[model samples]
Target: MGQIIIFLVLLGLGYFFGRMAESRHYKRIHQREQAYRKLLVMPEKIPPLEFSQHESTLVSGNVVISVDYFKTVAAGLRSIFGGRVAAYESLLDRARREAILRMQEEAKAKGADAIYNLKFETARIGQNAGQSLGSVEVLAYGTALIPTPDMRAERIARNNLVQGK
Candidate 1:
């Protein structure tokens, strides 16, 4: 009885802390998403011809997220029931979003106006002896278009000249 009581207490603590952490992570993701909304990220295989005046380079981001103890327990129960594992689904979703955000940040750092040919790769990492998924990894990659500084400067100069500045 004492062992059962201890187990329940631990489970409750895990659930509470897991929920809090997940909530905080989601809030941070939402804020970052809004902040990067102006960045153009697309899955088109070919960039538009008009934007080809710029140089294109590759950018990528990867993130690995571990499942909380509560989530792992929930997933085990879900597996026994032979149904969807909502806990794992949310974990993967969070990982994918984070990977995309990181990729966007890299592109922005490279002075890219847009990212095209976006691709995603996902994998389960760190499996335990029980074959349970220990963590998930997500990779987001794309080609970023960087405008030529000389061309931009010329265009600005032309505009200023036309405006009689």
Candidate 2:
């Protein structure tokens, strides 16, 4: 019957649109994950006289601080439906990597070969608290070691001789 064909077509269209919307939301999350991988860092504090004079001969590393947010919003919307959404895994993974990379760059800029004492934390903003929009923020820092000012000068001279140009 023509009615049956029309009904089937309508059903097919609905399924297609639903799939598209779901995929679009997921794609946006993926893009966020990618952008999250690009670590953004600020800078180190200018130490006073003592911090400047201390020679960093021991082993240590920079610190990375991060928060994971995924459950609060999902909990809010899940009550309206019969199921829960598993979307936070990728988000958390991406956030962790972002924090590490940021700290790594900071340590490298400070001439530190390694890092230690890394840590993490988490908190939830309730849906009613106006902070459950599903965003994670990470802050990382570390004590970096630079060569002695004299050694730096000598190293530069050695490099200048190698090229001889």
Candidate 3:
């Protein structure tokens, strides 16, 4: 009985703290997302015609998020019943969004006009990953398109100058 009581208390504490931390993290993510909204990110293999002549470089970001104690306990209970483990949904969402944000930051820093061929890779991390709850690693990758002066526009300007018109 005493052990059960202690476990319950720990679970309550975990739930309370986990919620607070997740809320704060979500707020931060939202702010960063708004700030980086202008940085175009796309999953299409081919860039738009405007970016056809742009330089390309690989950019990636990865984040490992650990499940809180409460989430682990809740997920274990949910697994026994055989249904969706909603407890871990937020965890994955946060990890994926963070990874994308980081990738966007990298592209912006490199003066990229846009990111193309966006891709995601996720994996379970930490000890005993298969047997128990563990951290999840989310990786976001894409090709950044850095703009160069448009060759067509340059040619037109050169011709105009040559013709003095």
Candidate 4:
């Protein structure tokens, strides 16, 4: 029967897709973790020159990344039958955390002692031509400031010396 043949085709397609998605998500997660690790590797090395006291303040930046087209197609096929797709959720969650962590590290590298001004923006990137199973991403950033009186004094002295006011 034609119906039977169509059903077989769909089923075969689904199986193949699911397998491919399994591997793709595995690799994506691996890459995401590696990215997080790279962001976190900022060693606490002082600059070659004598460190100047800076009353650092928090600053931040953010971005969102959508799921790939292949991923969307695979998820659509899987959704025709069952419960939630845990892999998709896990991937997005990990990405969100990585984005935030990257922003935090960026602030730290810029000599911020503590970060304060935080913001997050999220939206789906470009859409795919076929499947509509995309995701929204959220990014955040903040400034870091030193919390020491010595730094505050130095900053004040510098400001006064600059303006002669």
User: Which tens-of-lDDT digit does each residue in 66-117 have in candidate 1?
Assistant: 8888888888888889989998989989999999999999999998888999
lDDT by residue for model 2 over 1-165, one digit each (tens)?
999898667666655664465456557546654653433222434434434543443222222222223244344567568464554444455555555565655555665534443554434333345744345554444444445777677778999999894
Highest lDDT scorer = 3
Estimate, for each residue in 1-165, the C-alpha lDDT of model 4 and write its tens digit. 999898677767765775576567557656755654533322233321223344545455554555644456557777887778754675466556656666766765664544444555666655565446466667765445443677657778999999997
In model 3, where is the ten-residue run with the lowest total lDDT? Answer: 125-134
Q: What is the C-alpha RMSD of each candidate to the true structure, in Å?
A: 2.3, 10.7, 5.3, 10.6
TM-score of each: 0.90, 0.40, 0.88, 0.47
Alpha-carbon lDDT, every model: 0.91, 0.49, 0.92, 0.57
The better candidate by TM-score, 1 or 4, is: 1
Ranking by lDDT: 3, 1, 4, 2
- What's the number of clashes in each of the models? 0, 3, 0, 21
Shift in Å, residue 57, candidate 1: 0.7
